[model samples]
Target: MSDQLLQLLFTGLTLGSIYSLIALALVTTFKVTGILNLAQGEFVAIGALLAISLYATGIPMFAAFILAIILVAIMGGCLERAAIHPARRASGLTLIIITLGLSISLRGLALLIWGTDTYSLPAFSQGGPLIIGGAVLNPQSFWILGLAVITLSVLYAFLGLTYAGKAVKAAVINRTAARLVGINPNTISFWAFVGSGALGAAAGIFIAPVTMSTYDMGFMLAIKGFVAAVIGGLNNIGGAVLGGLLLGVLESYSAGLISSGLKDGLAIIILLVVLMVKPHGILGLLGERKI
Candidate 1:
């Protein structure tokens, strides 16, 4: 019984890390651009699929991963310049709707390119599961967790210790003031999408070994990530990561102890409860400053 619980915990953390990455990507974009990107998940699918294709061409694993992530980031910037930039004067609601449309279009493009097939990436390390007190842990799980930690750490440092990062925060906090201070809102917005795209793609590459990659997988992932973001407080970045891990653990326990069939529904239930109890999220308090 103890082993079973431990096993569930391990699984939950692994999956949660992926959710954290996705949620972090979403929240970061929203913070910098004030635009919630519903199409973020498509970057994940495209990254994994593109990585697979590149790796198949005999490129080394590291090179393939870099190439795919960079390509997606570039595409994100291009989309922002071509589609989103022109709509700069549109209302907030209109911008969100445009993102929704972008999501649909990306998914359709993915389907056309990858078809209905599913693909997988090789685990970062080849090894059998490790047994800890009779509970088994997969090697890929560590890679996922490590990736989450590294990504979070790097992002935190960049946002906290750099001039560009401060400029971004300033732009989001007050566009008029930021502009007066010589910052460019459009450039900030463009970079936000690019960073968001890179984060999404990196998540897909790491999780592909376990979840498998499919053309239609991004939409559901985006939904889950959004739920995580809301649970953590849309305005709080750290809250998003904690929220993803918390949600993942709860989902794991529900599946293991109650019924696997109820797993997907569990997220929505938690989201509702969170919204009702503390709408600002676990870390976000009323009148509190955002990070």
Candidate 2:
């Protein structure tokens, strides 16, 4: 491939990794509690904001990241209890609308508290780009990709090996059955919300320097993440990762060969076609497992 093409691909992977993290969180929440969770992006923004603020106060970057994640995770659990718990048995459409409203409300509240200015973290990684075989890669790129892989691996281990993770899987598969088996679906759902929030927060903390944090960032991130989730197959964790990487790379190529203005349109077109052709997603077959 040409130099420009190679560079774009690398750039795309970086962006795609961010999308994958966000989409994985979205999928996890949906799988466990059946909520669309429009507020997930707000979780991202909050985490980014917290990290930046704490870093400004002289806290270490690593400590800031962990604190931001913890705060968002707590908020996620609180949101589940306050907003979604009562509506768990409500229709899916209702739950979706409620979350959408919650998202809007949070966006407004963020603006009220944080104002409209954009904020960034003190550089999490050092200066300069690393060149490899005619492609330029930044430290942030590795951070995004490595974190996504590590997070996904951790998530896989949690769900595949841990008793609590299995309980969540069982709850996702069928709440009634999980309850029958002595697992409290509500407890599983609480854990799901916390895990999902932590994922979103982590993404925010990592990308804060790359994209900067603004109250409105979450709105678009949510759309992109939702698109990734649909492309990957809703509630399919592996599919979510694949979809995120695919979309990120596709957008990068499109921007390289086509117009940057058309990137969002292209993403939407891809999502629409996927929904029409294979709503089950790229790895939809995996959903056949018991929860």
Candidate 3:
């Protein structure tokens, strides 16, 4: 491939990694709670902003990052308890509307606290681009890719290996059955939110250095993430990953070959095509409902 193509591929992969994280968050929450959380991106924004704020207050960068993730995870649990738990018996549509309201509220709160200004963070490592095959790649890009791999590996293990993970899977499959076996669906759902929040926050922290962060950035990220989820088959975690990376590459190429404004439109078009042609996504089984 040419240098330009290589550059686009690298950039696209980085963006895809971020989208994958967000998509994972969405999928996890949906599997356990059956609610599409529109406020998921706010967790991203808050994570970045919180880390910056904490770091400015003399906390170490790594500490700030961890604390931000922990704080967002706690907020996720609190949101479930305060807003979602009471309405557990409500319709999915109602829950979605509630989440939409929560999204707006979170954005407004972020605006009040962080204002309209965009903020940047230093990359995890100090370095220039790495040249490979005549293409320049940012050091931070490697960090993103590495973290993505680690996060996905950990998540796969968590969901496939551990007892808690098995319990979560059981709950997603049949809440009543899980409860009959002494599992608390509510607890599983709550922890799913927490995990989703941590994933969002981690995505934010990783991407902020590359994309910058603003109070209003959450909705767009949420939209893109949601698109990724839809394209990947909303219930399939592996499909989400594929969808995100594929979307990112398509978006990158669209921007390079056409206009930046058309990139998003291209994604939507692809989504429509996917839905019409293959609604189950690439890795998703046609009849599989549970994670």
Candidate 4:
């Protein structure tokens, strides 16, 4: 591969890891509750902002990250109870609209609190870029990739081996059957929302050093995450991982080889093709188990 190509690959994979985290959170929320949460991205923005604020207040980075995640998770749980549970009987479209409303509300709230400022954090580690074949690789990229692998592995184990995880899967596949088997879908859904919040927040904080974090960042991030989930198969956990990586690579390559302005459009284009060609996602049609 050319030096430029190698560099793009590294950059793409790092970005893909962040997208994977967001995609996972979106998938988790959809599987547990049939809601397409447009507000999920807001959790990311909020979490990043909170962590940065906390860190600015002289708190350790580790403590700031943990506190932001926990607070966002709690907020997710509260929102599910306040807004989602009450509309359980609503149609899927209605539930989606509710999330959209929530998204707008959250964005407005964030604007009120944080204004239009953009914030970023220091890299988790202090080091210069690694050189290989005349391509540069940031040290923080390893942290991103390592976290992605660990998160995916932990989630895979949890869903496949643990009773609670099984219950979550059962709830995703068939809530009615899960209930008959003594599983509480409602409770599971609540916890899933909380988990999604933590996942989204972690993604936000991890990428903050690499990208600017603004109140409005959630809008585009949410769209990209949803597109990734759709392309990978919203019902398939593994597919989300694949989709995120694929999207990231495509974005990086397009930006490097073509025009940076057209890079974001790839998500919409790929999403359309995927929906038209294979609505079940890359793995969904293969009868992949929904994690």
lDDT values, one for every candidate: 0.87, 0.83, 0.87, 0.88
lDDT of 3 by residue, 1-291 (tens): 599899999889989988999998998788778999999999989988998888889989999999999999999889988898889899999999999998899999999999999998888999788999899999999999899999899887987899998888776666678889999878988898888889999989889888878998878788789889988888777767877898888899889877899987887787788788877775555555445
The residue pairs in collision within model 4 are: none
Clashes of 4: 0
lDDT of 4 by residue, 99-181 (tens): 99999999999999999999989999998999988998898888888877877778778878999988888887777888999
- Model 1 has a clash total of 0
Better of 1 and 3 by TM-score: 1
Please provide the root mean square deviation of candidate 3 (C-alpha atoms, Å).
2.0
Q: TM-score for every candidate vs. truth?
A: 0.94, 0.93, 0.93, 0.95
Stretches > 4 Å off in candidate 4? 284-290
Q: Candidate 2: where is the Cα deviation over 4 Å?
A: 284-291
What number of clashing residue pairs does each candidate have, in the order they appear?
0, 0, 0, 0
| Span of ten consecutive residues with least summed lDDT in model 2 | 282-291
TM-score of 3: 0.93
TM-score of 4: 0.95
